[model samples]
Target: MDTVKPKDRDFIQTVDDHLFCVVGYLHPPDGYTAYLKYVPSPDGKWGKDGRRYSRTLPFYHVSQVENTYRYLKEKYPQYLFDCPVRNITISWVPKSHVKQYYHPREKLGEIMSRGANDFLERKLLDLSTVLEDKAGIKNRIGVTGSILTETHNPSFSDIDLTVHEDNASRKLIEALRELKEEADLVKPVTPEEKEGWVKNRAERFPLSVDDLRNIAEKRWNYGYFEGTYFSVHPTRTDEEITEDYGDNTYHRKKVVEGTTTVSDNRDSIYLPAVYGVEDSDEVSEVVSFEGLYGSLFEVGDRIRFKGVLEEIRGKDPHYRVLVGGAGSPNGYIKWV
Candidate 1:
């Protein structure tokens, strides 16, 4: 069904059983290096290649990955990975391994990647199936009282992760509900309480938190995570827009009457010193000053405000800044 040709490239991969990072060249007709940017991070913690907690393959900026790849290849040489990174050989750590650090999702990823999708995500629809297919889970969500929500829409920047409790023992979920303070992601089967999702070569890869915020602030777009699909959008959905504002009250202030000026040139202009109006409150009330000047003058010529500031009004380049002598009852627009 897919029209796009399958991309093939050999790789020396550094992976955590299910979590993996492979170094390879992105094929192209135009010639460009790519960077993969994904992984779960409340604070933009992971890179694109599923290698988190460190600087690994950045899927977007592919040009700069040579050094990272070289280091990984030289590090792990025993695992006889496929020519292009397919089957991984590492399995089951020794009891004397003395595990200190906790990484819960790694185990979950391993289970899911190892033909256990039934109990993993179940195509993001059937948690019971994820349980049924996973040998360790036994076809039932083991934990008690958990919430699952499927999301498949994301902006260019968003970290995606999946949470499930099918394998967790009865004792674990019962104890989890009783606790207070604050807790992150957890599944009784894995050591880490939280973990992110990773795909060896998924299109529309997941992004970090910083990247997501950057996309939201700078790009004003939406992203998603559902089943195995990652989606990005140019404009945010209504739900996302509401999340940003954090309220249900949606209303537009109907602008009744206002003057307007449009220009893209940097030209000098003189604003006549008006009488009466010094404070911020007074400036806001002055209806005539709604949309007038390009740059308000102070003495001779010193551009005050600079930025593509917007406050509705059909996407204006800037907004009027309150400028005047402090506490003065009468003032004029001067340098702001």
Candidate 2:
């Protein structure tokens, strides 16, 4: 049987060969189940050179799946290619039905060891050089996203950089911010690029375009690298990977919404970024396994949020609404 991990992307021929982005701690009993993250489009709307394009797919709620499929069928029918819509979220394909699996770290290692061959790869190398010179993050960084799969169109693919280790990640981010401030080290996003990002975030996130632009501007980890967009993220080191969290089973409880203060966001860089909440009866904490939403909030921002409840040990333990799942959908945080 084919095995996969979080952040891996796979293709299913039964579903028009669209790429599904796997999320959550997968415990698929029969086959892999994930969210429909992207579809192949000849129009090049998703990327240059007719690369796969992404559309907004909601979280797996059984209830929302049908509506999502209808939206796709009506809005993106040309790309549908007659694939069954039910297969978008929880549908399983047997081991033999699996086609290809893309591993992020392995792909990053390949680019790092072999050197870049295309413009996107060269941009990554350029960014790496700057990071190495400025932040000492030469060996500690890896690549993720479309490039990791080798299907990336160099002209349109984004450079998804990941920094390992808590200290190094923090350092890398700090360096990126400093680079943006310096102006000479990195190029600024053009008006067109800024608008594109705003449009993209507006399509995928619940935040308004202005709020997203604000968040995007402050991060400094994303922007143009030789006219191509790139973003820097953090991951756990091998030492930080934990397999000791006892036997845990998950059940969807309810849709939770609240306005609460964040007591802490120190763990924002890690997966399932945990934040301690204060003065809220609905929840004691909020967690986002989705990386983008994780860092959106900070200490003291009263945020409006919605997500599914996850009961951790089932004995008055701290329950959290998982904000990121499936296609990185089902949850959003907005400034109040």
Candidate 3:
């Protein structure tokens, strides 16, 4: 279908999903079982030799295998041939499964609140999972946004964080990833549709990040039309996230540490980060590598060691750890 549009192509990732698939029909040679599809190169399709080099032959992910016949009837309606064209199919994987974009037509504050509410609604399922699976959980994860919906318009890259649990685990992360694909996201303040209340939206609703992002995209405040979306919470703030996702048991007692990695691009080097500091009678949550860009730091050099928990990039593919140093703070302190 040539579904790859410029905006939808670059940021659009064919997320690996176990749920649904999209089968494609391509122009193939007669009697040929399969043909090598050529994806254009970054440079250009036609080279000096008028030949194309390597291309990523993407795999298709289809759904509802039981309704293959029905699917064929819908897609290939005119062709009433009894047998399905076996080799005539070319597959395109699903890319729009995340969430549909939204178009806002109201005040900016209204849009921001709507966006926040939509984000919260989407995490309801995960929150339910956390509530059901965890043991001996004491603290509650608070859900809120960085730009508190009080302004006329919310800024770009604003965040909505849901903190229903105190700690996040690897197992929990996998579960969350699964939850994202299990269903598409929904947005309130939808035009002409019956609106859902805030309570009903947040508790029972579970949405994909894209769903909330659609809200942002439609609004004018943020770089909405730019088509970028990311949500960072209080914990994800400089302090909390620097530490590993609660996998720092080795350094928990002696020296505390925290670390995070890029989602992909394993070689992508980010600024070093250090979290946890003891300021006399107080504590600093996190200190980051970018925080030390100029002052007492030089280019091509690692972040200098500071308070007890210094965030260090580790050797393992996704391993980053922090260890205790001299006079580390008590780790926890009540905010005044």
Identify the candidate with maximal TM-score: 2
As a whole number from 0 to 100, the lDDT of residue 302 in candidate 1 is 25
- How many residue pairs clash (N, CA or C atoms closer than 3 angstroms) in each of the candidate models, in the order given? 31, 0, 18
Overall local distance difference test of candidate 1? 0.23
Clashes of 3: 18
Model 3 lDDT at residue 125: 30
Full-model lDDT for every candidate: 0.23, 0.62, 0.25
Identify the leading candidate in terms of lDDT.
Answer: 2
lDDT of 1 at 247: 20
Measured on C-alpha atoms, candidate 2 has an lDDT of 0.62
TM-score versus the correct structure, for each prediction = 0.19, 0.70, 0.21
Q: Give the TM-score ranking, best first.
A: 2, 3, 1
Q: Please give the distance, in angstroms, between residue 158's alpha carbon in candidate 2 and its true position after superposition.
A: 2.2
RMSD of each: 22.4, 6.3, 22.9
Candidate 1 lDDT at 42 equals 38
Candidate 2 C-alpha error for residue 136, in Å: 1.5
Predicted candidate 3 versus true structure: per-residue lDDT over 53-144, tens digit per residue: 22222221111222233543565322222222211133323323322211111122243345434443334334433423542232323323
